[model samples]
Target: MSGPVRSATTPSNPTDASDPPTSLNPILRGFNPDPTICVVLASGGTPTIFFLSTSTFEYFPGCAIYTSTDLLNRELIGHALKRRSQIELRTVKPGADSWASTLRYRPDEGRWYLANCLFQRYRPASDQRIFPRGFYVFTDNIWDDNAWSDPVYFGDPGFDQDLFWDDDGKVYLSTTTRLSDRAPDSTQKDLAIHISQMNICTGRTLTPPVVIRRSPHGIAEGSHIIGRNRIYHLFTAGGGTEAGHQGPDAPAMLLRRQTSFFQSLEVTMEFSTQQRGA
Candidate 1:
């Protein structure tokens, strides 16, 4: 589940009218899993930069950040969580501290937001509910590590949380529901995805959570919502987390919503699938 970031792109200047594209694979090396990348437009004389942030579980500076002007070369700029006051992991279980994160740059707000969850004190036998808290940290400047504000904690919905901005000036929070958080009689597996309107600045939920999609397998996480051409595209990872047991049931689904996101929409396609031999 851990590897480098690979990229395939054509040359900056195409020399011929008809030529095959070139590829630069493994652009960023090291164990960078559950990575989120975005393009930041250039301001003033600076070149447009591609920013990347990856999950750093149990690491001191959580959520390593990288930036690149071109797709070939990348630099480790800083981290989203740098200070001790930002995140505390004294007694957190190993390999279960910080989970997947969503990195975004808002042009209107002129800021960068990193949303993630902490799976700190999970004692299932004791039924203690003091783990899996979702929070976000913001920074006006991505280059400055100290500029990231303290985490604004939103109530724990689940892991692999996503922050999405709608056209009507509303921010929506999407996440996979944890099995422990469900009701006693609830039939939801570890695959349910929920959406809710939220106050992004204050980390406050403005509406009740709605069940959107449940994966066919028992696990569904890493869901992202993007809007284009008046249609909202939901890209979600469905199946097991590990590699050996993924089998033929593991597929990445693409669901589309033409109207409001709250409306019911059918699954449009099973866009990508990973099997044992495929």
Candidate 2:
């Protein structure tokens, strides 16, 4: 880190306090930093990994997908579902079709999904103003070359989506609320997560948006569910990067765990951290 070196891991509440020592490094921490992943159970009960990647260019901020077998290692699969396509930067303006990214996965339905937070502009025919909205996308196979389903709008004007699903066939999605006229220099707005039902079969969003969590420090949104038997756990990040100190507010990747009938963030902590920038 370039700034004052600051680092921590679930400081107050240590989940696995009694666990013994081990030497296995994190299997999947390559070019991707914040990962929202899902394990696809293939035929004969095999699990595959698929995740979302962020913007690589100016007008091509599309979500890239990847696949991994060993969990720690992976390969860039292809583009996220079509709904999250890049916004065309046509005008003399710098950016064309830019795309923001969001994601979720459904194993029972054998599909992986993503949402387009990639916001761009458009002047409607009647001179009506409308900021581009977010949408959803899905695929059948995670590891192999698969195609994304049609895009479906999930938010009015939003991006940065967080999603999760449980063992009992329950589904949830959390996302940031998009404010049309956010202050330019007012700093980054807090990221939000919304909960809803996702149809496991057709790969469709099935419920109204429900607010789960919001943070001014910005939400990393790479959420995963971990627990055994009856005990349930939710892992999330909370912290910002060091480079964006004075420019755009870089919030910490806040980590939080949840349980209790889909209510309560129960536990708040960190999994990985970067207190400063090099």
Q: Candidate 1: which stretches are off by over 4 Å? A: 1-21, 24-27, 121-131, 179-189, 244-251, 272-277
- TM-score of predicted structure 1: 0.83
Clashing residue pairs for model 1: none
Q: How accurate is candidate 2 locally (lDDT)?
A: 0.47
Write down the TM-score of every candidate.
0.83, 0.55
Per-residue lDDT tens digits for candidate 1, residues 147-246, read 9999998864678899998787889899877544555765434556788889987888888877677665656678888876557877677765678225
lDDT of 1 at 259: 67
Q: What is the C-alpha local distance difference test score of each model?
A: 0.76, 0.47
The residue-level lDDT of candidate 1 at 32 comes to 77
The numbered model that scores best in lDDT is 1
Look at candidate 2 and tell me the lDDT of residue 266: 46
